[model samples]
Every structure is written in structure tokens, then in C-alpha cells.
Target chain A: MGIQEQYRSEAAALLSSGEVKLVIGFGEGSTADRRRPLFARTPEEAQKFVLDAACIANLSTYLVTEGLLSDGKKVAVFLKPDGIRSVNILISEAQLKPDQVVILGYAIDKAEITALEGRNISDFSLGEEIRSHTPPPHILQEAERIEEMNPAERFEFWKAHFSKCIKCYACRQVCPMCYCRRCIVDVNQPQWVSTSSHTLGNFEWNIVRAFHLAGRCAACGACDRACPVNIPLRLVNYRMGKEVIDAFDYCAGENSSQKPVLASFKQDDPETFIL
Target chain B: MSEPFEPKIVAFVCTYCTYAGADLAGTSRLKYAPNVRIVRLPCTGRISPMFILKALQKGADTVLVSGCHPGDCHFTAGNYHARRRWTVFRALLAFTGIPEERIRFSWVSAAEGAKFAEMINEITEQTRKLGPFTQYQELQKVIETQSTY
Candidate 1:
């Protein structure tokens, strides 16, 4: 049987046997082409769960949300490889507990799911391997194109793109890892990012937002998928991710036991830039 | 033709070491630049990256965070953690095109009063040469104009 078929059956069995209170996965949206997150409470509902390229939302975002993970109920999340890393980061930050989650690793397309089964899916050993997996040709070309631009051109290119943003924050809303109870953008006393939606506000909002997710973002591309305006927000995140990896030899969401790169320190860290 | 540009320096000093060291500099009459305005915290670990950004946004020409030397932190490992955080934070600042000289971090224990004085004088001199922080003002105007939306 196919991996999707196997996942559906497994989900069905888990739900039927009372192993989980709910199974969260993807299902057909209100329209035929759209896919949306599904909350499966029964065995029959579990059969509706689908794993496809269109299943783009990072399901981990629901872990910390109120009324999503109840006191005694177990949450079974269908995660892609990157999605699993997000879960690891959340668990390490003490935002989610291991016992509270039942992760079902859904293999991406023809990729082998058995090689990854029951092992800690949050481990980042696969980061380099995943990067090697051929991205859609267009994405690779776009990333290369951005990398070729100088910083000023890169800044202007982003400024122009962000100028179109309406500040809907759908990008923030749909990200599984952006589970902060009080987002920095919402603080008004000092007004970190302007509350309005203008060019400068949009630029600051996007820059700071991307920076906060720098070391922790697992490159799930959920923010890019969620942006209503289709801003290439993940490009900024991807650049920062590469920088973190190159600068500190650290990768986020690889190990729950490892301290976050930004939260810990080394005595001989590079300080050539300091005055 | 113009008033001398006295750069505003906000120094975040840890209570057990740098803060005490600054106090010692004062008591010992060890002269240093008068541009620095100190905000004392219990430990350097308590200083958040947001605090540093806020200081820059609010008109500090330069921001300095001084703490206990590694292994000498009153809280055992507070300065160690701060050292790691500052390393990453400074990288992000550089990525954003902010001059790295504007943000400084150092380890100065209570016995290093002379060293602390020298650090301050050095920072003040460097910042005076760099002049006031006009980048923040430009960004602020950008924010103000963009806020209309």
C-alpha cells in the first residue's frame, strides 16, 4: 500500500483504539483545489486525512494554542520531516511535552517513511540531507538569484515586496513555531513594530519577525505559504538559517536535549567585528 | 559653529562586577568620559537583545554591556550565557547594516576599575568619532511615514 494509505490506516487504528483524542492532518478544503488542516476525532474521520504537496500548513502550530491541546487528550500530528523538527524545537523550549504528542511522520511523496519511523523525528541529522533533496527547480533558482544580489539590492528588493503587505499577519498566524503567547508585534507600550500597515512599518515588522525566527525556524515554508500577498518571506528566513549554520555550526530543531544556539554561549566566539 | 556632539552612551552594568567596578572608578576619582549613563542590573544575563535595540532606537550613540569575567559571575554562569547571546545578537546587527562598533560587550570584574575606566574612555572616543546615531532617526522617520497605513 502507498504511504498515504498506510498513514490513514494507522490514524484510523490509533483513533479507533482510543490511543489519541484527535488526529490532526490535511483534508480537502471547502473548494476542490484547496487543502486545509483537519481535526479527525473518529476512525472514519481519520480516513479523510491526506498527505500531499499541498499539505503546506505546519500542523505543529496548534500545539500551544488554547483549547487545542486539552489537559488529558493526546494530539496525534501528521508531520513532514521539517514539521517534525519544529515539534522538536517546541519540545525543547518546554512549550510541548513528549507524552502529550503522538507524532505520525508522513513521508514526503516517494520518500521512504520506514527509515524514519519511531525514531526521534526531531533530530536535525537530516538537515543536510534534506537540503540535498532537489527542491522544485524554480525555488533553487530563486534562492540562487537572491544570493547573488548585494545587500543593498537585497534590501531594496525586499522593501518593494514588503510595501505590498497589508499586515494581515497570516504568515505569523499559520506558522507552527510562532507560538509565542505575546508576540513582539502586539506590545504597544513601547511599540516595537508600528501597529499600522505602511512601507516602513511593514519593513520593520517583516525584518524583526524574520530575525526572531532566525535560529529557531525549521524552514518549513509555512510562512511563505500563509502570506496572503505571496511575499517570498521564506527567502529571508532561509538566508538567516544559512547564516546561523555557517556562523555557529548549529541547526535548530535537531535535538531536544541541545540548548538553543542563541540561548547559550561560547567563550571564544568570534569578536573581530567588535570595536 | 555647532555644540560639541556629546554622544549618549547607555551602559548596562551587572551588579556584582561591572556596576561595582564603575562605582569604584567613581569613588577612586578615576576620571573617565562623562558621556556614559549607567543602568545597573543584577546580572548581565538579564540584559535582553531587545533592551539593546531599544537603547539604540531611543538615541544612544553607543550601547555597552559589561559584566563579570567568565567563571566569576555571581550567578555562576550568567555572563557565559550573555557572551553567547551577544555573539549572535551582534551578528544580526551587522547583517542589518548597523555598524558593529555601536554595540560593545566586555568582561570587567569589580577589581578591574581601571580597566572599566579605560573601556569607557575608549568607547566614548570611538563613538565621538563616529558621531551621533543618525540611522535610527532615519528609520524612525521611515516608520512614522509608513505608519499612516
Candidate 2:
């Protein structure tokens, strides 16, 4: 059988044997080229799980659906290396219990799909793999080009993109790391971030969004793809991700037990910028 | 429109060190620029990045965050933690095209009153040369005029 069929049968067995209460995977999307999240609870439903190169929404997001694991039951979910990284970070952040998450890990290269040889979060050792993983070359070139621009030009470039924001927050909804009970943008008493779709609010919202995910982001690129206006949201995440590594030697989601960089610190962290 | 421009500088200082240092500057009769408005908190760690953005949103041309030196933090590693946070925050600001020069970070102990006064004067001078932060001020202006709609 093909990799997709193999995983489908595996998913079905997990449900039939009561090993997992839910199997989160990809189903057919509205378009042929697009795939949407599919949650399978029964054995029959598991058969509908579709595994392919187009199945790239990072299904680990569904695992944090607020109280899904409160009962302490296992939930199997389809995951790529990025999704596995998200799980590691989530487990490290105390957002999920590793024992309760069964990772149906897979990796996609080009147009081919292949199953990874891991069923548990700890079975995979991905620290070296994650540290070497770079974003697409064009993304790197664009980031470099942005860095070379004068502050005024950079400001205008981002302002132009942010102006198109309609405050839809499709990026926020799709991020597994964004599983906050109350996001900073939703706070009203102090109103740290403006709520309107205007440029001012958009800047604050986007900044806060990127700031919150600094070293915790798995670089899943979900936010970039989910953005309705195509704000190149991942660029800022990439920048912050790079900053954490270059400045502090901290890579997010390298392992399940790593301490979050911002939460922990050494006295010797570089402070040359301070006067 | 031709009036002399005085840039507004918001200084967020930790109470134990930087705030006390500013007090020393006052007691010593050290005259610094009057452009700064100081907001004192318990520790540098307590000063969130949001405070810096808020200062800009409210029309401040620059922000100064001063705290105890790394080893001298009253709460012992608070400055260290704040140091890490600001390093990350500074990069985020720079990456998003915000003028990194507008936000300053420094260590000010209670004994360094002269340094406090001199730093304030220097920042006021630099901000004066840079002029009002119309880039951010203009963003706030849109909110005021368009909020009615």
C-alpha cells in the first residue's frame, strides 16, 4: 500500500482499538490544490484521512482546542517536522502533555510524501535537523534585501503591506503557538493595541503578534499562508527567530525539554547595545 | 508651524536604581533637558515592551529604559532577564522598520546621578536633531481624525 493508505489504516486501527479518541488529519479541501483540517473520531471517519503534499496546515493546532486533553486521553494527529516542532514547544511551554499526544509524523519533500518512523513525541530526535532548517531561499533573499534598506524605506515597505490589513486575524487563528486564553490584541481596559483595521492598529497588532511568538515559533509558516492580505508575516517571525539564535543561541522547539529563551537568561547575555 | 521644536522623551526607569539616580540628579542641582517625562516602575523586568510602543503611540519622539546594572539588580537577576527581552525586542523593532535609535537602553545606578543627567541631555539633543517622530505621530493622528468615522 502507498504511504497515504498505510497511514489511513494505521489511523483506523488506532480509533478501533481505542488508542486515541480523535485522529486529526487532512481531508479534501474546497479546491483540489487546497487541503483542510479533518478530525476523525470513529474508525469509519479515520478512513477519510488524506495524506499528501498538499496536507500542510499543521494539524497540531487542533490538539490545543482548549480542554481537549483535560481528560488525559491520547489524541493522534498528522504532523510534519514543523508540526512536530510545534508539539515540542507546546510540551515545553506546559500547553500539552507529551504522553497524551500521539504524533503521526511525516515529511514532505518536493511532490512526494513519506511516513516518519516515530509514533511518540520523544521517539524523534530533531534538534540537529531543526537547527539546520532554513526557510526558502527567496525568503532569505527578501529578508536580506529588507535589512539593506534605509529605515525610511523599510518603514514605508511594511506600512504599505500593513495598510492592506482588514483586521481579519486569519494568521492568529491558524497558529498553534497562539493558543493564548486572552491575546494582547483583545485586551480593552488599557487598549495596548488598537482594534481597528486602520494602519496604526495594524502595526500594533502585527508587532504584538510577532513579538509574542519570538523564540517560541516553530517557523511553521502557517501565519504567512493564512494571511488574507499576504502580509509576509513569516518574515518578522524569521527575523525574531534569527535574533534569538544569533544573540542567545536559542532555537525554538529543538526539543521538548528545552527552556524557553526569553523566560530563562544568563548574566552574560550580550548587552553591548545598552549605554 | 515654525515654533522651536522640543522632542518629547519618555523615560521608563526602575525605582531602585534609575529612578533614584534621577533623584540624585535633582538633589545635586544637575540641570538636564526638560524634554523627558519619567515613569518609574519596580524593576526593569516589570517594564514591558508595550510601554515603549505606547510611548511612541502617544507622540513621544524617543523612549529611554534604564535599570540597575546586570549584577546590581535589586531583585538580583531582573536586569539579566530584562536584558534578554530588550535584545529580542530591539531586533523586532528594527526588523519592522521602526527607527531603532528612538528607543534607548542603559544602566543607571543611584550613585551615577551625573551620568543620568548627562544621558538625558544627550538624548534630548539627539532627538532634537531627529525632529519629532512624525512617522509614528502621523499614525496616531490618523486614529484621532478617523475614529469619528
Model 2, position A173, has a per-residue lDDT of 91
Off by over 4 Å in 1: A30-33, A109-116, A119-167, A188-194, A197-211, A229-232, A239-248, A263-275, B1-4, B143-149
lDDT of 2 at B105: 98
Cα TM-score per model:
0.83, 0.97
**Mind giving the per-residue lDDT tens digits that candidate 2 earns over B68-119?**
9889999988999999999999998888888988999999999999999999
lDDT of 1 by residue, A1-275 (tens): 87678888988998999988888888988876677889999999999987765566678887778767657678888777777888878877778777778888755555334414762344335556544444456766776786666655555566567777889999889887778779998988878777677655676677678778878888888888878888887776776676667667777877666677777766665545432
* Candidate 2: regions farther than 4 A off: B141-149
The docking quality of candidate 2, as DockQ, is 0.61
